[model samples]
Target: MSTTKWSIDTAHSEIGFKVKHMMFTNVSGNFEKFDASIETEGDDFTSAKFDFSGEIASINTGNADRDNHLRSGDFFDAEQFPTLTFKSTSFEKESESDYKLTGDLTLHGVTKSVKLDVEFGGLAKDPWGNTKTGLSATGKINRKDWGLNWNSALETGGVLVGEEVKLNIELQFIQQ
Candidate 1:
């Protein structure tokens, strides 16, 4: 078995999330800058480790006002917490190409353990002769758990934002 190191292809990868807004609509956004590193021993990812970091100031939701609000003390508090990070503690193979990755996720000012449902898309050689790998992961977490509790109660019912935030990650990596 050969040992390999992989680096995330930022240009072809995305880190995004969606949350229920005003109890009726879904607001989604993506981080423009993030990177991850993976180390593994052959096909068995048991010994693999992962580290990822994202810039909080690069958030884009297609709306400037919303973006600013997200960056303020109401949500991410980007000025106080300049980055969000994740470091894998363990990875369990659920199937031939699926895994459950458990790790520490840090956001806002709190850190908590989270599990991500990961799908390994296998490996292939690109047209340019470079070997690459693909992966997709998703998870959900309650924003309130991370201390992001700003919200407004609607006159009719429900809150301005949902507590649960759905996270989605699509990644492509180049073998190094």
Candidate 2:
């Protein structure tokens, strides 16, 4: 089998997330700087190996003050941790266009196994002639799982920030 390498088309991809705030509303955020790579044997996604990293300093939640707080020691501690990463342990195809991806996610110096649901978007050739593929992945994780334990108790009986964080990733990769 021949090995195939793929590089992320950053311009067409996004690493985004959402979290419940005050037990009522959802706050969304995204990483402005990140990279990912994938390798497979002869275009077979089931044999894929994935690696990804997102810069903590590049986090954006629309509000600068909130973004800064997320980068502070109370949260990501961007100056110390700098980045969050993931390395896939398994890529199992559950159907023609669905997959189960299990990986080790490292954030704030803590590592844990996580699972994500992936939907294949098929392959296509861009206008520039680059062969590309797209994938959408979703999952949920507890911020405290990675040492992001800073929070406040709301006077109304709920916490300021919810424990669960929802992940929504859209990725496009070009064959290399």
Candidate 3:
């Protein structure tokens, strides 16, 4: 196998999530610290080895109180978990620039298989002659499945936080 190694360009990547807040609007946040890598057999990403992890303490929502609470036992419990991670199990190409990636995602002390839809952004050459590529991955997971069950019954009717969490990952990798 002609395996090629690539490292994530952190400055060009972001890991973000959104969930329904209350029942009307959605609250979004992102992890400020994350790392990922790619190991492919060739130029084609049809099948590749991918892995990633993000610091739980780096959760940011533009609100310090909520961020701190997310790092607490009521949510991520950063002291005990410290980080969230994903290790790919399968990577299947959908047509030309589309793909489906299945992996094990661990969060808040629980591990579960999840799938992400990927859109390849193609490869390019940087000003310094480095080979770089970009892609966007999207997925959804039920927060309760990962033990993040903290919630409150709103007097309006529904719970405070929604169960489904949407994940958005924008990644750029430089060929190593």
Candidate 4:
């Protein structure tokens, strides 16, 4: 197998996250617009090239007010940053189905190395005769590390938002 180029099927993909809110429950959200391109030597993903970009203003949490707040400087500050991006640094195959993917994630003017556990979901051909593949990546990072430090102090006890932000990505790619 040679180096194959793949384009993300954004319609069938998702970039989402979850964070602790108010100290008790989790607030789940997804980015509505994102783009990714992948290059792999045949079916071997152990070493590949991956690049991803997500529009910060397209965040959806099902609440208009909160969504707007997220777009403000208190959070992503979409006007200034516009987008969050990731460029792969390395991929290490650990087991038959597990891979540790390390990448440079840039958000809010901060770039940091992040690791994700990627699970190759196999491949298949669609009715349209297109070769497709599935992948899922999950990771976590401290929000404050990226300069997204704005938060409120609850009068009762703890803070309003937690530091850890959990990331979950489900992607489908079609060979192009």
Candidate 5:
């Protein structure tokens, strides 16, 4: 197989995350707008490249107040840092279906190296005769490292929010 460029079908993909809120409950949300591009040849994945960029202002958690807070300086500061981005730096194959993807993640002016567990979801031709591919990835990062450390103390001795945030991404790409 020859290497080909694929554009992410954002309408069919999702970027989501979860964090511990109020010391015990979990708060989850998804970004409504984002873009990604991928290049790969066959299943070897040795020559693959991946890039993703997301709009911070598209965050929606079902509550306007919470969403506003997330976009404020105390958290993501969407006004100043309007975008979050990631670009693959390396990839290590662990199995036929699994891989470790290392990349630089930038958030709120902070950039850090992060690793994600990637699962190849195989490929197929859609009803429209378009070749499509699917992938799912997951990872965790400390929000404080990204300068998002805003929280309050709880009477139970824990902070209002957890420092670690879990990211989940499900993407579908079509040959372009």
Candidate 6:
């Protein structure tokens, strides 16, 4: 079989995350600008090669102040490390509609191997006759592991930000 290429449909995809704030409520955010690509043998994702990236400057959490703070040296330091990236090392099918995706995630100048759970959302053809596939992936990572250790001690006794960040990604790829 020959390799097939797929490019992300940005309009239908999002790279989002959630983290606990003040040891209580969860704060949600997402990158407004991002891109991804995948290459596989035909339509089999079990041995696919995936590459994804998100610009630090595009981080949006609804509040301008917080977004600016995240781009500062205390967190992502957008000036020094402008983008976070991921390159897959393995893609293994776990079931009919589920798979395990392992990759090297580079963020805040640090690179670490991370694993995510992926659910295949099947495929479909658009009105334009373009073939597309959808995927939903979830994962968790410790911010400190990627050198995003900035935090403040809350007056109420807990920390201002949680260490663990939950990843919630939705991807739509157009076959090319």
| Alpha-carbon RMSD, each predicted model | 1.2, 0.6, 0.8, 0.9, 1.3, 0.6
Off by over 4 Å in 3: none
- How well is each residue in 1-176 modelled by candidate 1, as lDDT tens digits? 78889999998899999999999899999999898989999745667788999999999999999999999998899999989999999988889899999999999979999999999898899999988988899999999999999999999988999999999999998988
Ranking by lDDT: 2, 6, 4, 3, 1, 5
lDDT of 6: 0.96
**What is the TM-score (0 to 1) of candidate 3?**
0.98
Q: CA lDDT of each candidate?
A: 0.91, 0.97, 0.93, 0.94, 0.91, 0.96
lDDT score for residue 83 of model 6 = 95
lDDT of 2 at 73: 98
* RMSD of model 1 against the true structure: 1.2
In candidate 5, position 91 carries an lDDT of 76
For residues 1-176, could you state the per-residue lDDT of candidate 3 as single tens digits? 68999899999999999999997889999999999999998787877989999999999999999999889999899999998999999999988889999999999878999999999888999999999999999999999999999999999799999999999989999999
Better of 2 and 4 by TM-score: 2
- lDDT per residue for candidate 5 within 1-176, as digits (tens), equals 87788999988999999999887888999999999998788645656789999999999999999999999999999999999999999877888889898999999999999999999877789999998988899999999998998999988798898998999999999987
Q: In candidate 6, list every pair of residues with a backbone clash.
A: none
Worst 10 residues of 5 by lDDT: 39-48
TM-scores of all predicted structures? 0.96, 0.99, 0.98, 0.97, 0.95, 0.99
Candidate number that wins on lDDT, 1 or 6: 6
TM-score of 1: 0.96
Of models 3 and 6, which has the larger TM-score? 6
Model 4, residue pairs in steric clash? none
